[model samples]
Target: MMLFQHHNTGIHLDSGSTFHLRTNEDDFKEGSLQGIHGGFHYASNVKGRELYQEGIDKVFDSVCKLDTRASDNVNSLSNMVQDGFDVFMDTNRENSFFVTRNGTTWRFGHHCRVPQKAED
Candidate 1:
């Protein structure tokens, strides 16, 4: 999903990186997840739908147990992953920046480059 930079709000972690992503509900919700189903290993099988539903159930159950709130974090990213989305790092820029998944490019804040590294 595309994460637009917020106008002002920012989050600073212990690593000194600052994430200034837009918290607006729509910013991270405008994307399609159908690609995930198509890429699944069992997508061509007769039981593909059942397999996908089962996988989704497991992930949804896990997410429900997390304390993180969609309003305050990159919850959409997790949701995307659970649905079988694969994120691709943007390589066109010299500096660490946005990343893409499916057809959406998620732009990041000045310090919100690599999500994992930013957490550290």
Candidate 2:
């Protein structure tokens, strides 16, 4: 699959943005795969989730960040390192999600939760 990052928004690139150039958001629709979003978690915690989300977000999966135009979200994210998330700092926003088309099927990253497997 092709891998790259959006120039402006800095969102991760995947097979979805096959022909995209500018990246304020996944504004251009590249078939049905344009909306595949959030499939992983940051240690399943806020900080871990946020950075990890940011790490690969803009370059496998296509996810966005919805937060303060200034500082609130960043500050909140900092607190999450120690105290974890409060009521307001709920997991990332759904708006940052993405949709993508893969062949005859559509793959949604955020929508597809990683499977749970228990082992001894």
Candidate 3:
């Protein structure tokens, strides 16, 4: 599955890494994951996904200065592991992003990349 990284946002992380990306638009797909599927023994995308998510958060924090502390990023993320989706990651487990069981739905956690906050 192809993942669409958001461009045109000029997103910059606090670590100074610019969010550089591109898409076919006509053939672009978006999701929360990347890398190889390691069954249960491997979970690379999970960590990589976290870093990607963190980078995104840093970008938002940097570009918008919305450095609000998350009360349960880990808990929410942990729960997602049970959703039965297949997760993939790089060899180093740095970008262990998520991929759906159908091999279609890809993207960072909905909460991680999405800009809107649900109402309390």
Candidate 4:
């Protein structure tokens, strides 16, 4: 599990599975892992609301892409997003949720129960 936090914003990653060794037969000499399951949460003051919401929108978009590509399985990417949220919030059930990818490029998605307030 990896956790990164700065002030009221934080990210938590839980690599659920182990890395598998890949041989030349698979075209790679080194081993590779699949992906991560995690969640992100942020709280900002009123002054930072616009920027924070923009960030949240980006995350939400990424998750939607992952969900579309994910298969119907317990360990699917969408599930990973939810799992990450559960872990980060330390709750067994749902809360405000966001999904993000790791590495050089990043993407995100969103799932939230509460209605977002209108922009000023």
Q: For residues 18-82, write the lDDT of model 2, one tens digit per residue.
A: 11222223332333233225533322123432221121122223223322221211112222223
Q: How close to the true structure is residue 86 of candidate 3, measured as C-alpha lDDT?
A: 52
**Positional deviation of residue 6's Cα in model 1 after best superposition, in angstroms:** 7.1
Root-mean-square deviation of candidate 1: 13.8
Tens digits of per-residue lDDT, candidate 4, 1-120, equal 222322221122224421111111222222321233342232223221111111111221222111111121112333454534321332354342333334221212133222222111
Q: Write model 1 residue lDDT over 7-72, tens digit each, in one string.
A: 332322212212122223333323312223433232221332221111111111212111112233
Q: Between prediction 2 and prediction 4, which has the larger TM-score?
A: 2
Clashes of each: 0, 26, 19, 8
lDDT of 3 by residue, 61-99 (tens): 211111112211211233234545454545463333544
TM-score of model 1 (CA atoms) = 0.26
> Which portions of model 3 show Cα errors greater than 4 Å?
5-75, 91-96, 109-120
lDDT of 4: 0.24
Off by over 4 Å in 2: 1-29, 32-38, 43-46, 50-120
Error of 4 at 39 (Å): 28
For each candidate in turn, give its C-alpha RMSD to the true structure in angstroms.
Answer: 13.8, 17.1, 17.1, 18.2
Q: TM-scores of the models, in the given order?
A: 0.26, 0.16, 0.26, 0.15
lDDT for model 2, on a 0 to 1 scale? 0.25
TM-score of 3: 0.26
